[model samples]
Each structure stands twice: as C-alpha cells, then as structure tokens.
Target: MNSCPFQRARSPEQKAERRAQILEAAALFFAEQRFAAISLAAIARQSGVTKAALYRYFPSKEALFLALYLSELDAMVEAPLPQEGPAWAAISELLIARPLFCRLTSILHTVLEHNLDESQAREFKQALLACFAQLAARLQRDFALEGDQAIRFLMQVQQSVIGCWAVSQPAPVVASVIKAPPLDVFQVEFGDALRTQLRALQAAL
Candidate 1:
C-alpha cells in the first residue's frame, strides 16, 4: 500500500516571517561578499531556501538589493537628530549614528560605479536629490534657513560628504575618523563653511 502525504500552505504571517528571514540572510551575505559578485543561489543557500523559493520572494537579485537599499534609506532618514548642537554637528551625528550608515554609503557608491542600468541610475539620482530636498526642508523649518539658498547649502554639504566617502582610501577608517572629530572642531570648520557660503547666498536673496 502507498501512503499519500499533504503539505499545508503557509499563512500570511508565516510567509512574511519567511521573507524576513530570507532578507536577513541576504543582508549578511551581501555584507560579507561584494554585491555584484554574489549569486542568487548563494543567497538561497544561506537563507535555507531553494532558488525557486527565493524567486517567489524576490524575483531577481536586483529586486532584493533594491529592497535592501530602501530599508537602509528609511533607517537613515528616521534616525533622530542630535538634540543639541550646531546644525552641521547635528547632521553629522544623524548620519554617523544610523546602523546602516557605512553599508548605505558603500552600496550607493557601488551602484553609481556599476550594476545599475540607465533607468535605475536615474531613479537612484532622483531618490538622492529627494533626500537632500527633504533634509533642506527640515532645516528650513527647524532652523529658519531661507529659500533656495537653504536647499543649495544642504546639497553642498551632502556632496562634500559623498565626495569624501568616494575618494577616501580604506573606507572604514575614513568613516570612523569623520565621526570622531570634536564637536567644536566640526562646528567651527565645517559649520562655518556651510553657514558662510549659505549666508552669502542668503544675502543675495
């Protein structure tokens, strides 16, 4: 006699739990290996799912990466600004304290340098500009910065930070150094730089 076996379909909660597990595993794998080099099979193996099952959750590696990218962005934007500081110091602290900060920067650099298609690259650029725009809006509301000048100042600060990250050798070392400088040091130097340039623009306005 032959016996018949039945498998139960997972509930929505169970499916979501499995997807989270896969994402967590993928995040670890991506952190350990280069994003461009890692295969979906490797992610599946690490995630303890078959490739087909992984596909059901994430159609492609790019999709999975995009999900991860957005997650990192959410974390960065949601992090609390420092309660008391000059504007630049507060901004630096917010950037540095995010759990995904270094990885987020690394991923952005990686995407810009390779892997992204033209459309995807355009979308990424838009998202970056949008983030800066939001930051500028927040600054204007909180600190009373004026008009387009405020937005341009925010953009300059963002560009300066990205430029530093891009050319810096030994990425981790540079990330650490930027975070460790004294409050006064950053406020007097970087803050003055932003304020002077922005105030000049504000004066013209």
Candidate 2:
C-alpha cells in the first residue's frame, strides 16, 4: 500500500514546533509587507500547511498575528533594559531595535483586536495584561515610580510608539515627497522622537 504523505503533529512538542513554524512564516511576511497586505493563503503556502490546518492552529488571521505579537511581548518582558542613571535612553533603544514589535503594537487596537472572537480576545488581553504588569513592575523598581505611575508611564509610552511609528511610515509616494528640502521638516525620526517623548514623560512623572 502507498503511504499517506501528510504529516500530523500528534505530540505536544510536535504541535508546538508546528505552531512556531507558522509564526515564523507570518513574521517573514510581516517584515516584507504591510499588515493589511498579508493573507492566510500566502502564509499557509509559506508554512507548507493547508489553509484548513492553519485554522486548526489559529481561528483567524487576527488570532495568528495576535499570538505572534504576544510572543514578542513575552520576549520584551524577558529582555533586560539597563537600570542605570536614566531609564528613558535604555527604553528608547530597546524599542528602536525592535521595529516589528513596534509596528504590531501600533495596530493592536485598530486592526488585530477587531476581528477576534470573545475567547480569542480574552486570551489576547489576558496575556497582554500579564506582560504589561511584569514590565510595569520593572519600570517601578527602576524609575522609583508608584504602581499607578508605572502603569501611566507605560500607557503613555504605548501611545508614543503608536503615534510616532505611524507618522514615520507614510505611504510610498508621501515618503519620497517628505525627503525634499521644504518637506523634510515633516519627517519624523522614530528613535529620536520616541526618546524625546519618553524623556519628557519621565521628567513629568
């Protein structure tokens, strides 16, 4: 008898490996294209999985990207920021180094959260809160902030990243236009603007 060709992940470890492979494929697509431009069929092809198999791992495109974003958040929480004389510099540098994370975060509210079902939404938010709480605790310890202050600081930083990233990444034509002498003033340098905003927020708090 001819052997069946499709491979199935029966063990938990195999399932996790399959999930990671899918996430990796999604990440590559995200790096090269805008969020709105990516599709499940493309991702399925890249990951060597049928669209049906992809749905078994993730209910929707939103759910899959949300899972990837959550993994990024977990990595950020685990990464160490400098606990030196000033916190803003370290934080700014960290964000600058992670452009994909910043981009995903920029769309967290506007896109990724919209199509999610209740269970998916709850799971994402709960994981998000856990990441936030851990990061806030570190901020409080490093910056001598009260609990509320730390939370507020993070909220402000989130807003700053979202706003700054959006402005810095204009449409292709607009991006070219902005590089001209007269329009150069409108161009926003993500790292510089973010550092300035973070420094101001730290000073205010």
Candidate 3:
C-alpha cells in the first residue's frame, strides 16, 4: 500500500503551507540538480505529496519552477541594494549570491516558459515586466539613467546574466576540459564576468 504523508490540504492557511512546502522542496532540488534532471515525481516525493496532489498547487514541473523563480525574483526586488556601490555592482552581487536564481534565469525563456499554457505564460510575462519596471525606476533614481535608457540598461543586465551563466556552467565534459591549462582560459567566473559586463553596460549608458 502507498503511504500518504501529505493529506489534501483543506483550509486556505493549510493550502498556503502546503504550497510553501512544495516550493521549498523544489528550491532545494534545483540547488542540487540541473533543471532538466528534475521531475515532478521527484519533487512530489521530496515534498511528501503524491504526484497527483502536487498538481493541486502547481500544474506542471515548469509551473513549479516558474513559481519558485518568481518568488526568488520578488524577494530580490523587495530587498534594497547597497547604497555605497554602483547599481550594476550591487545588482551583480545580488544575482551571483543566489545560485538557484541565476540558474533558473539562465534557463527561463528556454525551459521554464516552454511548457506553460498561454494564460500562465502571459501571467509570467506580466510579473516579469512589473519587476523590470521597478528595477528601471531604481536605475533612473539611483544611477541617473533616463527613462528608455534605464529600461535598456536593465535589458543589458539580464542579457549579461544569462550569457555569463551559460558560459560559466558548461556540460560536465566541457567543464572537465576547461580545468586544463589552455582550456582553462575558457572558464568563466560568474561574479567577475557578470560584474565586468554590468560595468561595461553602465559605461555605455
């Protein structure tokens, strides 16, 4: 017989707690494994819910990941950046410290958004645009970037993070090869590379 560790959550509070549990489990799984390597079944097991029950909160693995990604982004947006540093530097530091956020960001458009239905996809875009607007406001106020320029700077930052993250985390075979002398030149330090890109983008702005 199958064990039922997570019952059907009934109350609104219970549902909220169950959702948090699922997201926490998903976040931990993402931290230790590549996104492609994880499954809804695995996340359900980790969260102590059946795969069927998991759907009560998240429609799909992509949805689950998207939710976690959005939560991470929301937290980042809510936190204030350091006052002493350049905005780009502070932004780079914030992103680099959150490995799961960086990893998810790298695969966002490629993987996370791939399986979403139209409504889910639209919601995700809306949320992201809101975040960008908030960030653009920060750039205008703190960094003296004008309206469109602030938006452009934010776009450049996202591009740099995605590009740098991809280069920094290659396939296992490529990673091993990069450990050797000449190939070592190809290795990317995420923070340094991202910061450099951000600095260059700011200079151009």
Give the whole-model CA lDDT for all candidates, comma-separated: 0.60, 0.86, 0.86
Superposed by TM-score, candidate 2 places the C-alpha of residue 99 at a distance from the truth, in angstroms, of 0.6
| Cα-lDDT of candidate 2 | 0.86
Q: Which 10 consecutive residues of model 1 have the lowest summed lDDT?
A: 1-10
lDDT of 2 at 49: 73
Arrange candidates, best TM-score first: 2, 3, 1
Cα RMSD, each candidate: 8.3, 3.3, 2.5
Residue pairs in candidate 2 whose N, alpha carbon or C atoms collide under 3 angstroms: none
Better TM-score candidate (2, 3) = 2
Model 2 Cα lDDT, one tens digit per residue, 1-205: 1123337777999889878888989999999998889999888878877778889999899999999999888888888888786767877888898998999989999999998778878878888888889988987887777898888888899999999999888888999988989989999989999999999988998
Q: What TM-score should be assigned to candidate 2? A: 0.93
Q: Candidate 2: minimum summed lDDT over ten consecutive residues — where?
A: 1-10
> lDDT, candidate 2, residue 105?
88
TM-score comparison, 1 vs 3, better candidate = 3
TM-score of each: 0.59, 0.93, 0.92
- Model 2 per-residue lDDT at 3: 23
| lDDT tens digits, residue span 1-205, model 3 | 1235768889999889888888998898888888889898988888878899999789988999999999898888887877777878888888888888888989888998998889999999999989889878887787777989888888888888899999988889999989989889999989999999998998898
Candidate 2 positional error at 22, Å:
0.6
